[model samples]
Target: MSFILGFAGSNSSTSINYKLVRYTATLIKDPQVRLMDMAHCPFPMYSEDYEKENGFSNSLIEFKNDLQISKGIIISVNEHNGNPSAYFKNLIDWLSRLDRNFIKDKKVLLMATSGGKRGAIGSLEVAEKMLSRFGADITGTFSLPNFFDNFDIDKGILDDELAVEHANALKEFLAKITV
Candidate 1:
């Protein structure tokens, strides 16, 4: 089976985006999913001086390696103040320094979730625009709005209408990549 790497942009222990990604990962049948928790992959804040002095963190190197081996990527971004969360941006900054094309040639399913009605749309857009330039082959994009009302912590999506929408999006994503 093809190996797919999945992660959330947020590092929060109880991130809605993380739950969304994990639930989506379970729907794919052909690919074997390996979920990554950003909280575990700690790296120092990105800075020119820091890079020059300490070099790339081991966490960054390991993350890069994971991307290199994976056939596809699934990321659900979390928005903070209508933008990508600082934790996610920091990882991106460090990864960019290592290789601008770190996500090169991988089919990506870009997603996001939020408690608000917008569903972290801003952060998803930002990730889509930036990662595409770095060689991410975006297969599909999805967002779950009003996460608490539509999703259950253990049972996945709770609302039928929203669940169908998400399932269709995920189906399209898997189809495009697996082909």
Candidate 2:
């Protein structure tokens, strides 16, 4: 069976993106899901000096291992100030230090959720650009705009129509990539 690494790119204790990522992972029918928290594996900010001085954090190395072993990834970003959250960028930077092409040949499901109208569009585009350059095989993308109003825990996706659309899109993409 394929295994998917699912993560949200925020460290907030009550992150809506985390909720959305988890929800998206659960929608996968065949693959086993392993949910990871960036908060649990925080790494120091990336710098060449830091890399030469301290080496990669053990946690960051382990996170890299997880990515290396996974068949696919489901990642949701939480944007701050129209960019990646500090926690997310730190992880990305640390991972890149191990290999400039950390995501080389990896399949990724890019997703984002936000409280505003754009749904973390800035961070989503930024991640797409960076990860693609690193050789990520982007399978699909999703965005939940105005997250608080669009999604409800009790009701699942508040917009059932949109939820079906997103779920179908994800399923199709995952199918294409897994083969």
Candidate 3:
């Protein structure tokens, strides 16, 4: 595997989901990892009219190119009223327009985290289903709830049990990343 791509659905600079994605990327030892914050990769909201008028933007092309070269991906999504956030949904819309199968055959470790107890599971579930349609081979999932209480800025996951679960999921994700 050349590199693993990691990103969160939320573009917020302070997003807990992005923190979780970064923590997960830290656990991987060998491969070159690119940890991207969605804030820096913004593109216009997708629309047929806009696409017809302007085609793919340079940012969208670069984002798709990153996906093309990645051997695996670690993604954590944010939730909004028990569904994926509109910002992330827009990102999906744009990426799909470029190529529905842009993520084809890529190994994926799906994850979610939030301040709430459900840990953004709603968005996680939705993304799991949606990513498969985009041709991601999802290998494992981990949800860390109550982010404030369960995670530390320097320490990563605080709960020992959840740490084990996260590690196991990451291990599985890494084992099959080259398949």
Candidate 4:
């Protein structure tokens, strides 16, 4: 029984990215999924001073524990200026201090969503590259552009074709990783 962690980068209480991540996680079969929220991590801005003073917070320790034991990860990052949100990036920085290869050799499903043409654009690419440098084995990548129009709360993915496409992509990604 493989365990997977699912989370979005944003801390917004009603984050669409979080909702999408949760929905996507349900598409995977035979995996125990643990959904997480960035807000609960409660990490301050990434600074050497803060890190030295505070060390890894309890929530960060808990988050890392979950990752260390999981078989794979499902992450959906929210973009801020064509990059990872400050909150998520900060968390990653802190995790790296604990272990340089924090995500090394771990299977990863990387995704991002936004209301722009690029749909979190270069952020996903950048993250994949950086994480891979630390040995992250990214199995698949998904980007949802113009999220506001493409997805909705009541109906989920509004476009049938797009929905099928994303579902197939996510399923394929999970299949490659699980057993």
Candidate 5:
């Protein structure tokens, strides 16, 4: 079975982005979904000096390996000051160093969620533009706004309009990867 790697950009234990990604993964019927927690793949702050002083961390290597094996990816990013969360950026930096094309042309379904009405659009846009250069075949995108009111930990998306939008995006994503 083809595996799809899913992860949230935030490391928060109760991150809404995490919940969104998990819910998004459930929409894909065929692929075997593997949810990853950034907290588990810890790495020191990435810097050229740090890399020279200490070799690549094992966790970083394993993360890259996961990307290598997966047929597709689902990433739900968290925004901080109109940018991707620091932890997620750090992870990407390290992985980029290992291989600039770490995504390796795999289809990606990019998503984001936030408490504000903008739904972390800034970070999602940045990822869509940037990740493509690094070999991500971005198949689709989705955003969830006012996450607390629209989504439940147990029930998933509560808003019908938002749910339809999300479902359409997932359908497009599945078509791209499965074809």
Candidate 6:
């Protein structure tokens, strides 16, 4: 069956961004959602020597295959010092090496959440810029500020206003990625 791939730009075992991805996946219907964790499918540091000596690992190849089959992607990025975390950035570096245009022509629904008020917006902006270089189109975005205050593990987005906004963003993303 056709599916959309959802993942968080985080390798942390307790990443809030991953929680957001899981919640978002539940909101999507029709095209099934496949959730992946960066922590689970690990990648070594990207380097010319590594690429030449090892080529693409089986795990990387499998990830690329999944991306190719995906109707779209949902990524909830995590911020570190106002940018994407080192682990996620490294993964992208290796992914680009595997196929410079692996994400090309894919529609993306970008989201981020953090403990702080900015809600990892800096990383979201950086990711948007970088993904554009790979030819991925960001069709919609949402950032949840003060994640703990506004979100509940079981109930999802807590505030009515934010819930409506999230729903709207999902609607926009669905319009672009699905027939």
TM-score of each: 0.95, 0.93, 0.97, 0.92, 0.96, 0.97
Tens digits of per-residue lDDT for model 4, 88-107: 77878888987887787888
Cα lDDT, model 1, residue 152: 84
Question: What tens-digit string does per-residue lDDT give for candidate 6 at 4-60?
Answer: 999999999999999999999999876899999877877888899988998989988
lDDT of 2 by residue, 1-179 (tens): 55889999998778898898888877777778899866676577778898999987777777788888888888999898999888888878778878776778888989898999898989999988878887998888888888999998766578776687678768866886679
Candidate 3 structure lDDT: 0.90
lDDT of 4: 0.82
Count of clashes, each model: 0, 0, 0, 0, 0, 0
Candidate 5, which segments miss by more than 4 Å at Cα?
none
TM-score between candidate 6 and the true structure: 0.97
CA displacement after TM-score superposition, residue 82 of candidate 1 (Å): 0.7
Error of 2 at 142 (Å): 0.7
Residue 5 of model 4, lDDT score: 91
Cα displacement (angstroms), candidate 5, residue 83, comes to 0.8
Best by lDDT: 6
Q: After superposition, how far is residue 172 of candidate 5 from its true place, in Å?
A: 0.9
Off by over 4 Å in 4: none
What is the model-wide C-alpha lDDT for candidate 5? 0.89
Candidate 2 deviates by what RMSD?
1.5
Clashes of 3: 0
| Backbone clashes in model 1, listed as residue pairs | none
How do the residues 1-179 of candidate 1 rate in per-residue lDDT, one tens digit apiece?
46889999988888788888888888887779999987676777899999999998777898898987888899999998988989988988888899898998888899999999998999999989988888889988888999989888789988888888888878877887778
Model 6 CA deviation exceeding 4 Å by range: none
Rank list by lDDT: 6, 3, 5, 1, 2, 4
RMSD of each: 1.2, 1.5, 1.1, 1.6, 1.1, 0.9
Residue runs of model 3 more than 4 Å from their true location after superposition: none
